[model samples]
Target chain A: MNDPEIKRRGLMLVLSSPSGAGKTTLSRLLLADDPNITMSVSATTRKPRPGEEEGVDYYFLSTEDFGLKVNRGEFLEHAKVFDNYYGTPRGPVEEALSDGRDVLFDIDWQGTQQLMESAEDDLVRVFILPPSGQELEMRLKKRAQDPPEVVASRMAKASDEISHYTDYDYIIVNEDVDMSLARLKSILTAERLKRKRQVGLSNFVRGLQQAL
Target chain B: MNDPEIKRRGLMLVLSSPSGAGKTTLSRLLLADDPNITMSVSATTRKPRPGEEEGVDYYFLSTEDFGLKVNRGEFLEHAKVFDNYYGTPRGPVEEALSDGRDVLFDIDWQGTQQLMESAEDDLVRVFILPPSGQELEMRLKKRAQDPPEVVASRMAKASDEISHYTDYDYIIVNEDVDMSLARLKSILTAERLKRKRQVGLSNFVRGLQQAL
Candidate 1:
């Protein structure tokens, strides 16, 4: 009794979190669990490591090419980090969206802000937080053998990131990884059912109306 | 390491559908499964049916009382059907929302429109549809021993109701009850975590910032 398959316009799901808030783990689980969504590949000028594959890990570009792409506005959002350039390519994300495949982005708040300006309607921003400041600091300490000053500096940066929670549409506190993952799945599922995203819904409904 | 429990502002979840479209079944399943949401009780001028309890089923009211409440703007929405008046009392729903308990409404499109006008920020509207027009007709016929004219009338009404799908935030086609219920639960869970509904998030974030 179901109608013909409805077409959907995909969304850009941005996950922004502090260094120790478990965003990467949740994103990995989501990609593994949901086949409809793919991780967004960024273009980077940084030299790829031995195991990293071009186009899969990143679109490895030369410095001059990266600057040219930026000037041509090919990147949806780009930034210079240390000496390397990194940006989300506008072409593939738009292509995936038009084909009804969601793109997941693991980006910082600044990158998310840039995407917001370029593609507000297509974006769903979620800000993840650690269970507590103390827990975040502990995770940072345990992750590396960095000295106290380095750990302190990371904590300050995390605090700065956490301050931008208000800028996001949804916020998840990473109390338990499993619970947070479940919440993330729910958010994605719900957002996909949003009226605006279902591109063929009007035609489907109109068909029913005519059938009656 | 989790922060203190944050307060929330509850939402009004309105589910609307035409007759025999599985709305009642889905609503019943949702209420039985979820503890945080409760069915909204309406005040009615109609006499109670057999075994229907006051306040639990409805707040039975006299016609005069209903009129007075309407005059005072106490009802969120009101309507007259046949010889009786029916309305959603604004007081209890408001009280529940302020206490972080979601109120579920099995309303028609008109009632949903009123809620949108009166409480836009608190409202989350979902429109449910039968999987197909033929299925809807079959369900309506199977439910009763009605004649052809009655069935035809119902089909027309369903068509009219389905036309308002654009007015809803989410749409779910009832292909299977279990799947539809799952989608409803996801919508509820996701809407609860929206940033605007989490009232104490600012303070919680501030505490994290200060600790760092």
Candidate 2:
């Protein structure tokens, strides 16, 4: 239903959630379903895992190179997690936005806050929550990659992360993945229809008025 | 899925468009499909048409009663169109909103401005436009109730109405009815998920935190 004549600036869709809250699954689903959106590739100082490709999985960089990019102010939002530094590169996302393509960010609250500071108008922040504490613990433990002590530590971190739910524009208590995905798609659809985002609307309306 | 534990305050969905922009058709379709939203019945001084029922089609009132309601500040918005007066009663709408039921208004730009003054936070205004000036004229002429002279006058009035498109929150160029209806539903769904509209979210989050 989009009018070809009316050009729109794309929005920054940031989905933040605690670990094991189904954010990754939802993000993957949305990317596969929507043609207009692309996942944001982050630059990280962490070593790449096996089968992880450069630029596709992440922009793997040494500490010096990452520091240089940070000094150059090339990242939209950056943070240090444990001993590794990770940040979203600013150039590609800006290019996508101007060309009317959305960039999706699967980041935490701190990264979302940084994006808000830089591009408040373009950002649509949605926080995802587990149905209950018990559910969250179960999901965390079900991932057998982590031991019990790791799961306990992750739960503590999840508590801190979920505390920032009020900072988001929309909160989804993700009881079911499909329902949450539908709501996320609805948010994207509605935000695209916003009057301010349609950059060429004034010219189109002006042309209509002149024709009348 | 809606969580019963987290209550939400309803939104005021105002749809404004020119006479032949398919707003009325879209409104009817939305009302028939969505059980959660109801039309905002206005109180008017005009005599009821055949089969028009009181408190359903309209709350037909005398000029004196309408004037009294206006003087008492009972109307959320009241306006005199030609010789007759029409208004939205604040009491019923407020009751519905507090009960988590949405009210849809098929009013013009003037009435929408008044609604914005009274309930800016609650209002989600959408303005529809025809695909072109020629299409708008064709649609107006297709309605056989109006004569050619009336159609010409409506075209003039439509030009005026179309100028207010920038004042709306969302703008839809109505190329097809089904597409427009889908966009309308997305807007409602997204607005319902807004953080400010979710009234009981804080307590729900607090409960989750305590459980954690």
Candidate 3:
């Protein structure tokens, strides 16, 4: 048996946030601070964007290849968004989790639901919300890349996204960056301790019983 | 309405561990580190040990008073151990939670179940385990307060307690003191983020629709 002190594979951590709510940034911070976690790179049918590489940004595939995988039920979770098929391939994520690593997903609510339905036992969901409506609008406006109408559309869409906050296992208000990040860190740390996630704990307890 | 940024009330954190697993120490560190939390002093028919106080150590109720509270259903949860009745008083804990103060309960598995059944929405249960049987025995031996036979008895009872580990929402292996304390801290922090616990998130989102 492995060392009792060492934790075995952990559950998948799915974080969903509104367009500008900082989930991507939080994911980067977690990966930088903790070595035991890896982001689950999705497989997509869409062509790679500029400077994006296969296997790094995503497992870029043709529509036919993505369709084949979908037919074979190979993906743990998948969805079509904006004319592109995006999916969490079951193989890599399972391998990562079995090796005691946490897999992070930055996806929308639809993807989260699929992941939960497929592997509810191995998933923890967190939703991030902008602290206030005015702040949310301001953040969208500051992007400056989007047209005013697009900003208005996004602001309108954000309300719908925020309405589903209760569907998440955890909801964090993105009021202060540092504080929000700290709260996310604590959630990760605590989720790791969940009885269901710690596979070694059951064996360890049994060993303790026999020794006593 | 109150500020949406403010959390409605603090949570009730229940830390359950087998005898000799150092839960008391963990609870103390959590309280010392978190200003928002309060230790929930339970009422008990058991007499105070050396250096313990009434109300502070426990409510120290007479049998009649304890029975009266139980009869009136004034306790959130209660159980009998070794012929003495111990219970968490409803009034104090409810007041504390409503006022945005977290409460800590260093209780047993049975008491944990009762509290969970009663105030599941408000409770986060964590079970702590000693690293191993040998390590647990070593720690018990170090305490030097109990005789060998008594220690053996306690150890024998530990397995039954640990069997219920899965009942808890979280579990921690207490190998290193500081690390376990950090794990407990993470649990408290993350539990505060549970979507169900946040009262105003839905209304806040609904209000945002108007701004949109």
TM-score of each: 0.97, 0.96, 0.92
- Once fitted onto the true fold, the runs of candidate 3 whose alpha carbons sit more than 4 angstroms away are A1-6, B1-4, B46-54, B145-147
What is the per-residue lDDT of model 1 for residues B1-212, given as tens digits with 9 covering 90 to 100?
A: 12247788889999999888899999999999998899999999999999999999999999999999999999999899999899999999999999899999999999999989999999999999887778888898999999999889988888888888889999888888999999999999889888899898988888777878
- Name the top lDDT candidate: 2
TM-score of each candidate's B chain against the true B chain? 0.97, 0.96, 0.89
Model 1 Cα lDDT, one tens digit per residue, A1-212: 12247788999999999899999999999999999899999999999999999989999999999999999999999999999999999999999999898999999989989999999999999989887778887899999999999999999999988888888998888899988989999999899989899898988888777778
Give the candidate order by descending TM-score.
1, 2, 3
Interface RMSD of each: 1.5, 1.2, 1.9
Q: Give the whole-model CA lDDT for all candidates, comma-separated.
A: 0.90, 0.91, 0.82
Error (Å) of candidate 1 at residue B211 is 2.0
Two-chain DockQ for each candidate model: 0.72, 0.72, 0.70
Error of 3 at B60 (Å): 3.4
TM-score of candidate 2 to 2 decimals: 0.96
